[model samples]
Target: MKEMTKKIAVLGAGSWGSILASVLVENGNQVMLWTNSEEQAKELNEKHTNEHYIHDYTYPKELITTLDLKEAVTGADFVLFAIPTKVIRPVAQQLLEVLKELSIKPILIHASKGLELGTHKRLSQVITEEIPEEYRSGMVVFSGPSHAEEVANKDITLITAASQNLDNARAVQKIFMNKYLRIYTNTDVIGVEVGGAFKNIIAIGAGILHGLKYGDDAKAALMTRGLAEISRLGVALGADPSTFMGLSGVGDLIVTCTSVHSRNWRCGNQLGEGKKLDDIIQNMGMVIEGINTCKAAYELGNQLNLTLPICHAMYNVLYNDADIQEEIEKLMTRPGKSEIEKYDEC
Candidate 1:
């Protein structure tokens, strides 16, 4: 079957967003890369470079950069949001207005990971609430163990396109699949989103372990237990327990926790090295999603009466200014139980 070209408006000109936009352009899509920064738009339009995010990478010349939300989304077949989770609602609201004004219904997709701050809602839920059903065709989440730096370099990468609507997920999979990038379709949106969001918290813990000079034993243990915590929360929130074992779940956790490219892991490494969170964030110049995710998951766990020790520890360290060593000690001293016991309960 001949592939149909899509007009996609990719909101957010950050690393991941820029890379995905370029990929869409390469795939023969009419891609619009949107950024709030007029200067960034000018640079991308003129130089085909987004230096602040992905350095030394040239974007496809066919990719267009836009500052006008209305201009980007008008007649777009798909609106792919790659912005931070915290700003999802506001952006969705803004997008909603533009969609309404233009009288167009675009399929909404999000590549961002992280739960909403105060509501502890998944990013999909937030977008759904903000964008009325009449104004959109469907919703899909793009996630898995993907890093912008690797994808920018055209390294082999695999990711999932998830939605309750299986057809929509498959559609996304077809649009994104290429020789260097493979896309899988999954119907478990809840599990995929939960897994994708929660893994950042674990990645931070992994980075903390690394910065503290802990051996592989500790790193392995942290990741295992972290998966358990993720499964617990996901199950409580109506996600399939099996999804935690898939690409968006364990796959994402493993990569984010171990990779130096992970913003969350790098932030935790700095924290473990005795740097202040504010200072680390300032230096990093990008969102460290784990810090916010840790807080959201900590609260969500409490509400669900779930014990997320790793998330709780991260929360204390990030929000309470609690000592990292003390937090680790506390986690280590917790009452012992069979590892499978928690999994069984979840």
Candidate 2:
């Protein structure tokens, strides 16, 4: 790897953002962790702990937290979008406003996942639309199975650093890539983007099965069938089926579904156990992407005229006031279909 010194600006002080910032500073990069609250900035820069969001971890001296968007990105060599999916739009707009003076561009990496609900556009599409076209050349997505909780402690993780620019992708791959964190490169941003967003749905389903006290046998079946649904929807959207087998696909789906750390899965577990969405969110104090994603995926399937049976069942349960177990029974009692349908991208 080429010797390098860089400045990293991590937008969003959530668990993922802080963990990523810690990783950046550990790599000897100057990291400015951006937070929305001025109070959070003070806490991060002074006490080194962000109690309001990700508690218990204090940042090192090299890591500085700031609320000034421009100050954070002034000379940054790399930018990571770790904010939740919904806030990405206004946040990117904020970045564009701050970056107007810069003719020279820095590498852009999005660590966030999901599509804009209404337009059904991926985060990469939104980034390309918001940021200057000049910056588009350096855009990449660092996505995969690493959860924020595990990543903060520097546990072994693997991810995809995908870009059309092989050189730029390799640079990102090397920056956070370590013995514990393996980085894979992909030219199919569409595949990586779609896979990451879609997996959360299956994760929610996995959580439901667990919540219902279904044993490993049932959970395994749910995951396998869920992977089939994911590949089907992704391939219909022009992603390569082979990409479905890789880290951003199967690896991510498995982790999110199985891990208690997954918010989406937890949300589904609550629903399965007969709790209200409003109550669940109020208790957790964080957004559950899968709940909203269930709606998005359902609408997108209708638009595409694709038969996402699994998603359809999930949506029916979520929005139509359909009985949850009835939906499950509905799926189980369906007419027998060829087993090969699961593997084929139709």
lDDT: which candidate is best? 1
List, residue by residue over 1-346, the lDDT tens digit for candidate 1: 8777899999999999999999999999999988999999999999999999998999999999999999999789999999998889999999988998999998899999999989889999999999989999999999999999999888999999999998889888877889999999898899999999999999988888888899999999999999998998898888899999999999999999999999999988888788898899899988888888888898888888887888888899989999999999999999877777654363
The alpha-carbon RMSD values of the candidates against the true structure, listed in the order shown, are 1.1, 1.7
Question: Which residue runs of candidate 1 sit more than 4 Å off their true CA positions?
Answer: 342-346
**Per-prediction count of colliding residue pairs?**
0, 0
lDDT value, residue 161 of candidate 2: 90
Cα error, residue 263 of model 2, in Å, equals 0.6
Over 1-346, each residue of candidate 2 has an lDDT whose tens digit, in order, gives 8667888889988878888898878877888888888887888888988776666877787899888888889888888899888998899888887777654477889988787889888898888789977753489998899887887777889999988788888988877876677899998888898889888888888888887887898778777877787777787788888987999999999899999889988988888898886788889777787766778888887887777778888888767868878888988988877768743434
Global local distance difference test of model 2:
0.83
What lDDT does each candidate get?
A: 0.91, 0.83
TM-score of 1: 0.98
